[model samples]
Target chain A: MAENILTPEEIIKRGELVFKKTKLMTDNELSYCPGCGHGVAHRITMEVIEELGLEEKTIGVAPVGCSVLAYEFMNVDMQEAAHGRAPAVATGIKRVYPDKTVFTYQGDGDLAAIGTAETLHACNRGENITIIFINNGIYGMTGGQMAPTTLPGMKSSTSPYGRDINMMGHPLKITELIAMLPGTVYVTRQAVHKPGLVRKAKKAIKKAFELQQENKGTTFVEIVSNCNSGWKMTPVDANNWLDKHMLDYYPLGDLKG
Target chain B: MEDVKLMKGNEAVAEAAIRAGVDAYFGYPITPQSEVIEYLMAEEPHKRTGMVVLQAESELAAINMVYGAAACGKKVMTSSSSPGISLKQEGISYIAGSELPCLIVDVVRGGPGLGTIQPSQADYFQMVKGGGHGDYRLIVLAPSTVQEMADFVELGFELAFKYRNPALILSDGVIGQMMEKVVLPPQKERLGDEEIDKRYGSWATTGKKNGRERNIITSLELKPERQEAHNLHLQAKYKEISEKEVRLEKINCENPDYLFVAYGSSARICQKAIQLAEEKGIKAGLLRPITLWPFPSKEINKLAEQVKGILVVEMSAGQMVEDVKLAVNGKVKVEHFGRFGGMVHSPDEVLEALETKIIGG
Candidate 1:
């Protein structure tokens, strides 16, 4: 009963704050839609870097998508790459500043579609960097167009009649494909829909950055995310849908290390 | 001490990059300029000066890599041929819009599409008139010899960083492949991280130091008014470059009846053509533009006041001719002549073309 009677100022003065936002995140507001995973992804990433004590030495490359302005939210030195060229851009940064931690934040369309060559070559060359891939199955920023990772029968704007495997071809399992490349030292797939899953995804991101310090090769972390607005579903329904649908194809867990 | 060597233009560029203390070179090899990466790999500048050299999978990746390093306030560069350069335009535009400093060497060959591996100056328009999509200008340098090829590496970086813009070394296949004696500059040490921070701290993404806001290298300004302001700022920088960076060489223009305006290999041809014209008592002079974008427009325009006719020679059908004519503004008769599509015109043909195209017409 004494705790309940404590004043808010007194509780704060007693250093009883349960959780605080990481200073690595800037004051600017995030642009993600309500309940979008990008906000969580961005915070966990910034938290990981902060926890690792690499805040002052991290450089990030942001891709073209809903997270194109990742630089605005994440308070770190950053470069905005054209389309899917984030890996190549990170390669440039890491090579120049071998002591610094460099990573890329890219969307499914950026990583699996237009930027395939850059992503593959960066992985193939084993560039000592981290690639944070956000796979939402659909192109979120482009108004729900079918992405390279869109499900086989998923209905998107481009696949209005539903994706016909015979016509539109198969959805790419790029994370699996990336794990096979010898250049990648660690490759894992994760999600952040729930608090427990968010912690696991953050741990995976932290491990990827830790692996980058070893300078063995490329480390990739693919976060199987949802684009609720693009999916035309409510946030809660999207999470349930992702669990029932997306997880069946993109099972969560480490594929390589 | 100055180190001199006999080397191909492409090789000279590679060697010059090392000597200039470039921090990184990421490039994909292409015909007429493959020697750039080959020489860098063979020499291993990483061992010599701790510079990073990577042969990228494609020109697109190479240019983006250059963008990344440049955004970090490092001296970075990339080289490719015509077709490869075309693939790099997207990155180049992004770099320009971000206002990053880097060098792009284009050892151009003939092209509407992989047209030839031979020496050609057909890329004059593409290089001088903004090859990428944007309201941006690359400080274009035309190197006429293997020596200039080596020298411009330093000059390009200086100009690029001075204004925080991209600088292009525009050499055609002839100069790229030709062997000549070059006086390579002495090696300068690569800039250390602290030094880069000191010099480019205001804008470069050299990591956010304690007590500083994070640096963001980006071209995206979603707000229309802010984007317009950024564009205007870039245009202002370009105007300053055009006013101050015009480089040209005037040969025997004291009193000439006719003038020959050319650059790169075409300038070399016109030098000999001028001698032949003198032998014919034709009194011809040459105005060779060194900086093609911040063109020798002022010099050419002034010279047009004195000459009766001006002949613009290039390897293209008539690319730089438009710039030349614009400069002259009908003050004197201007005509264009050259062999193209992998063809090189002889000195005699240049003289004949000048006689027919400018005088006889």
Candidate 2:
């Protein structure tokens, strides 16, 4: 029996490669934990920017969270904003460089809680920018603290007895709220736990950027992510839990366009 | 021919910003400084120089907006009164730590917390002592006249970019509201895209083009050693600025037995006080600080050796007085006197305070 063999260069020359990382991403390793949705979110966002050939004209604002150093991975001109101020910062950049594509990557705590005012006002003002929000139900960077998105009965470091609705306040469905704002031309929620879902989430992100280019208004894409390390569960268990619980609360699909 | 205009201090600063070629102005309305945004809005600078004038949601948003623009190497600025300035401290610290060049104008009003809408120098400590967190220094310029208010808009941007540091034009409600004759500088064109690329391309977050690496504007350094190194670099820059940037004016100091240390509106009041003292045969001199942070410490110390006593005048209870005392260092007796919480001290009151506080007491 004769076995056919091909060199790596020949495989690339023949365009037979299965997958290649986007050049818009840097060589630096992602700071997210294994199986964490942040890595996927970062990858897809970069892939979208690469697909649109906006690597040179894009400026990204990174919020204070596990991805505070998103600038380290996203190979583009970037600014790290004070906690929850990414929307306002992105607004500033977009207004000054109306021709440049500007976007912000923020987590729930940085977007829905401490930065709620900035986020809402930026959206309300119809800023021509995109906001990539990651909702993981818990504060991943600050060690599993209960976040504004923490579901009822969810256990976190701050909520040792599991979240009580009355005491901890009900989970915020901020995506739906943002969709209602006139400034937001497009708003959607999607997950990245499965291969099929990751593709859909990538589509949403790409669409958001496209709308931003249209100068329509604020474009928001929420990635319902899982934080296994902060959730104190195995990656598989976290995905299972997110699918069973987080999905019911933050159902996937576009709320506005 | 000089374009001379009789304008209010706030209006002069606004006009000066347009002529100085500021790229953008992000501000929110606040007492004592509301004219800044109002004037900019009415002038429609976008038509004049393509400047982006935005009314932000709040002072916090305004300052952060400035942070974003400055990171891109744009000449951005913001203005607010004391209470509003308090809200911007966090963003100000971030801008300082990131070492981005921008201007912040504080048309100061009285305040421990919204104390009054009237002029006060209570923010002297806040401006010169690094109001926000971290070890950082703002290049503070105290403008005593509307001309200086107009002049400092250009000068502030110059020093801010020269050192890649945040520069503050510390005015007061009095100067901001008072009308004065100002020779506005000629309109210089704003920096074009190619100019910005040529000038700040190395560090500014102006698109990662021309095959260069992505530029990041952040103050975070997780590594302790690296953070320390960044702090050391900032300190060195500040030290160099202090050595090269101390600005002050000496009036009637050729020989004097009594001296006054003041800045901003207080400096103007002290000038009048100087005239009154001379009439009373006191032979008083005035030392006015133009740059409050590089402070006129060395000069004040030299003068302390000549004068019998020194009195620091400010609208605050006594903020800059502490710095004056530090400069005098016990060589001569130093005293402080001022009307607090929106009250303006008259020339008669200032001379009387000099006689009673330093001379008689």
Candidate 3:
């Protein structure tokens, strides 16, 4: 044999060796709903963390709801915050360790309704943290109930017949609310349902992190996701529903560049 | 060397917050203290000094942002007036329960609801007693001048991170709105890694990449024994803080017949009261508490041996009088003078009280 003549293979071997040295998310069972948008969000967040090479210096704050397994899924330092308190928790982390990147992944119902105070204030005050808000228009983890962003006429457990805007008040458009604040440096709304939008959204999420790296103020990206389990729609149906309903209300692309 | 500057109390607080190496500022615009946020907002301290400042939608959100920033080991703070402070109680309680360190500046206004934007010290009781829920105490510092308002910012941050507890700078409209001369300390860089890691990293919940166990900074303890242990631990910390943090003042206690004690704006009144009494040769003096919660009882005990009586005057209806009595230990009589319900006691009122309570006899 010609002694396995290969110099390029040695470089490949060394690169793989370097990866072995890198601390990455190890084998763990992810209990995501089949074809749920949360899995896509988690994968992208993990990919960003790995790409940014911040596995050690990044702090992840996850709120109650679907992303509760965040600690188990992400290979980084993670903490669980009370419902709607992830912003506050991430604020603490980022403030203490200014060199570290701190971000929170929150659900719509948690961020807009229960955690409204925290999200608004953090973004308004330019807390120097990043927030990934998943707006699915319904509560998924709690067996499908009305959320703060639920469309006016949408029906759920809370609104058995339908959500009467006259009685319940109109659905809140949080992106518009936060984008109006002076402290907010970046605010973008995107959807993970479509492939092109997914690519664009992943870029937006990455840019949000870059803005943080530059010590700019708070960055908020509202990811219009789907809760097939709660929406009672199949994976394909849910994506189609999001395309038709969520984009009209949320409107993808940067609300504030 | 102390660097001096002339500024109003609230503006000094805003400037000092940046000098303290604050990572974030979250607040709402309220009278008396509105200028603090205004200065930060207009001057753009967020970009100038590498500080983060935001004018929040409401007091509720502002304080919660403080709660958020504190958890991350950041030097964070917020400012608001009386009614706004009341709205902040829920988030304050959570911050207390979590034992996170931060600063809150209350430039108080008169209020039961939408009351005047004028000066008042009515929150003495609320700040001293636990204003929020749960069995926790915040370290309260009352500043008397524009100088101390600035000085207290650094001190509050020190005490906050020192005890891993929140520190509040309680001021009224007079001090916050009025300008005065101040000599500020030179800005020091925030704590370095070895210091933070050695002191706080053990408990602070950063990421779990340290090859150690996952860090959790929670106050919840469902089991009775665990809860009891947690309570005892908090009590022990409080006792330690009380022993070390009590600060007070004394004036002309030598062979004195009467002693006067007051704090904040009310204490300023007692100064003139003491002066008026001294013109008539009453040997009166003023004892002001820079730290109100610890109550400065030790100094009161020392004063009790020589003076015939100690008088406690305040803006509230004699709330701090209980603490004065507890401090005096019946060695000398403790008398209280006060005005309540959006009314501040004038120097003449304090003088009258001094005349009836001490000089009359």
Candidate 4:
């Protein structure tokens, strides 16, 4: 039996690299849990910054969540903000260093719940910064508690009997709310569950950063992600469950630009 | 000499900050201290000296904005009243823990909760004792006059950068709203990015240029040993500050039977009380603390041996008196006098307190 396989040296000589990590990602191990989307979200963001050649001038604000330690992974000038204050901090950085590309990476709990004021005000003030919001429907960092983006009838540690709309209120569609603001020049909801969706998410992130470079007010990109551990599902099942439930409420694609 | 301008304490602080070449000012409009931002907005410091002045949504946002700018190695500041300052404690603590240099101005008003907007020295404990959680200290400076208000802005930033810690100008509504003749500092050009990189490049998060490692600005230390080490480092810095940064003004302390310890507007009142006491044949002296956190404890301790008693006059019920008693260490009689709820004590009232409490007792 003959195996038609090219050796590693032959493949290198042929200039074929199926996949490689971006240099903008540091060598530090990610602290995210297995089957979590935070790692993917972080990679795409750094990849976008690298693609834009903004590695030298990019400043990132890491929010308090699973991605709180994103500064350790993202190879750029990073500032860690108190829970949910990333947008306000980013506003400060962008205003003082207007020429630098500034962005904030935040989770649903940080952005939609605790940081609603900061997010809305920063957007309304037309601060020239990019906001990367990750929505996973539940708080994954501090146990699987209900989040502002948790869907009705979705069970969580805080809402064990399934979220009751009357008791828990409705899931907040903050991305849509942000799109309504005049200060937001661009707003989009994307995902990174699959290769195709990952490509789209990367494109959205790139566009957001580009808009910031043009000094064109706030550009918000929300990534509807999956928290497998929080949802008590395998990675594949979590993605499928997100497709079945989350996508309906938070459909992908551009809402504003 | 630069031109002298009759300006409010708050306005002087704004002018001094602009002339000091601060990179940015982020603030919310709070009474008594609103003039600082109002003046900066009207002056458009960005156009004059390339300083970025922004009216933040809240004091919470304002302080974090200062944190963001300061993390990038820029000279930044924020000003607020008591309630607003309370809201900024978290950010201030974070800045302290991270060892980022920034300036904060608290135009103190009466408080325990939404206290009156009148000038009060009630925040003395909060300013000097680290109101926020964790072990940290802000280089607190109390400006007694509008001149010191302007002068302390320069001094606050200098000390902030020198020690890589937050410095505060603990003014009151009286100082913030009152107008006086101030010789404004000469305008200094803002530092360019190159200068900032050259000076603070080792730790500042300016950018990852010159093949430098990415600078991370955060107060989070997950490891217990590392956190303890950071705490010890902070304590050492505070010790250095206490030893080297003690500032006070002594009047008649050389030979006096009674001493008055006061700060901010209260110091001015104490000065008048000293004269009134002298007219009554009571030799009284005043020790005004310019640096409240350092507390001038050593000076007060030295004066304790010479003076028969000490009286602390403030706008609050009694705060700084504790520090005075601690400094005296039971060597002499110590007492406190104040008027709260926006009340200003008269010179006669302070003299009466000294006569009734310290001298007579």
Interface RMSD of 1: 0.6
- Candidate 2 chain B has its poorest 10 consecutive residues by lDDT at B107-116
Model 1, B50-108: lDDT tens per residue?
Answer: 99999898999999999999999999999999999989999999999999999999998
Native-to-model Cα distance after best TM-score fit, residue A91 in candidate 4, in Å = 0.9
Which parts of model 1 are misplaced by more than 4 Å? A1-15
**Candidate 2 wrong stretches, greater than 4 Å:** A1-15
> What is candidate 3's lDDT per residue for A1-257, written digit by digit as tens?
67756576786976744333224454677777887887677777777777786666777788787876677776666666667878866765665567888889999988999988888877876878889999999988788999999987887889878789999988999989999998789999988877787788888988888888888999998999998888878999999988888888888889887
> How far out, in Å, is residue B184 in model 4?
0.9
* lDDT for residue B337 in candidate 2, whole number 0-100: 95
* Candidates 2 and 3, the one with greater lDDT: 2
Per-residue lDDT tens digits for candidate 1, residues A80-189, read 99999999999999999999999999999999999999999999999999999999999998899999999988989999888889999898999899999999999999
What TM-score does each of the candidates earn?
0.98, 0.98, 0.76, 0.98
Q: What does the lDDT come to for candidate 1?
A: 0.93
- What DockQ, on C-alphas, does every prediction get? 0.86, 0.82, 0.27, 0.81
How many clashing pairs per prediction, in order? 0, 0, 13, 0
DockQ-sorted candidate list, best first: 1, 2, 4, 3
Model 2: fnat (fraction of native contacts): 0.76
The residue ranges of model 4 lying beyond 4 angstroms of the native Cα positions read A1-15
Encode model 3's per-residue lDDT on B33-121: one tens digit a residue: 89998888887865656677866667776776677667656688999888999988877877787788999999887766888888877
